[model samples]
Target: MNAVDSALCEAFAPSGVLRVSINFGNPVLATRGTNGEPQGISVDLATELARRMDLPLRFVTFDAAGKSVAAVAAGDADFGFFAFDPVRGKEIAFTRPYLLIEGSYLVRSESHIQTNDDVDRSGVRLAVGTGSAYDLFLTRELKHAEIVRGSTSPEVVNTFLRDGLDVAAGVTQQLLADAKRLGGLRLLRGNFMVIRQAMGVAKSRGDEVATWLDCFVSEMVRTGVLRRAVARHQIGAMSAPEVKP
Candidate 1:
């Protein structure tokens, strides 16, 4: 990897430290360590980026993606991993995705919601993490279903069960774990969406910072940095295919 240009460092770490936002809500990218610290692919990527930039590293942790995105957009953090969403793009500039995570729906075993499309019917209340990629996407796409907001992705199933919602939507891995843990729940047959998870800095960081980040991610994909991170973490997500910059 090339030495990070001084200007690039200035742009990414304006406070003289690289503050990376880690969202533990997405189990496929991050999880709480035994010591209560953040760990997993997101942390590994953030650490690697800071090391390459030679900046002092700091973590701004959140339990939900919305809070993580807010921290980056509000300049409380320098960069964060996020699912690509046009709604969030208004405040963030993202690289090409480094990972693809499936989004699916979970339903009670006796529920009539047997397919992803069945989730869109009127009177069927669906629970989703507020401001999640799927939340933003389904809000726009689902014409009839009433969307209930879960406090966090990991809690969506709990919210669904608590309120007796017809469907619970979130990362497939998370839903699968929830299904196995709670019993009598099963995920729909197919994914409703593929979340393109990528690293992003606030749009206020300027195009130069965005370009550098994009190039860095493309290199990570090409050189297997992302693949190794996924393998090391043993997460369910797949590394995104390399894309020409």
Candidate 2:
């Protein structure tokens, strides 16, 4: 490889191996296999990036997005997949989004909450995963509602039910599955936000690393690597369109 490429490799794998932070919090990107191994679109992309870099790979796994972000931001891992948020942007240098997943809310079937607008009224208790993208988003946007913190995204529904919160906010697909599994719950009409999922390295890695990561994601989309990975994993979220110049 050329000197510039070698320098990037050394920066990315400073400990002699690429450690990727894999978050199982977002079902669209990753999940545990029957054999208990991490499997999904994020894993496929991380593996491909390592292969292309000719670097040995390792996964630093977490069940929560907040932990994954912390690991990468602290330089405990070389890379991570996360929903792009301005709050997180302080520590992570993110690529343009590769996936667009809807952020939605779920409510009990008999609850008076009827629409997305109704969710923002006073006295409404909304449960959200602590430090999730939507939690951060809603924390900034919701004017009157109270946001109750769940330990992780997957547990948002449980927290909502356990605390008797009025709504559970999270990824649409995950909430849909939770509503189906537990019953008596319905999603609020439409979505509250569209989560822009992307790969990131710590800002400490420098602008060059962020630029290269963006190029890598763009090439994956152009060559249909992302398309195939989504199809292979049976993810329901839409692929984000390439950002035009």
Which candidate's TM-score is highest?
A: 1
> What local lDDT score does residue 130 receive in model 1, on the 0 to 100 scale?
92
**Candidate 1: regions farther than 4 A off:** none
Query: Candidate 2's residue-wise lDDT over 1-39, tens digit each?
Result: 223388888888799899999999989989999998999
lDDT of 1 at 44: 88
Q: Which residue pairs of candidate 2 clash?
A: none
lDDT of 1 by residue, 118-227 (tens): 88998999999998998999999999999999569999999999998899999999999999998999889989999899999999999989998998899889999999
lDDT of 1: 0.91
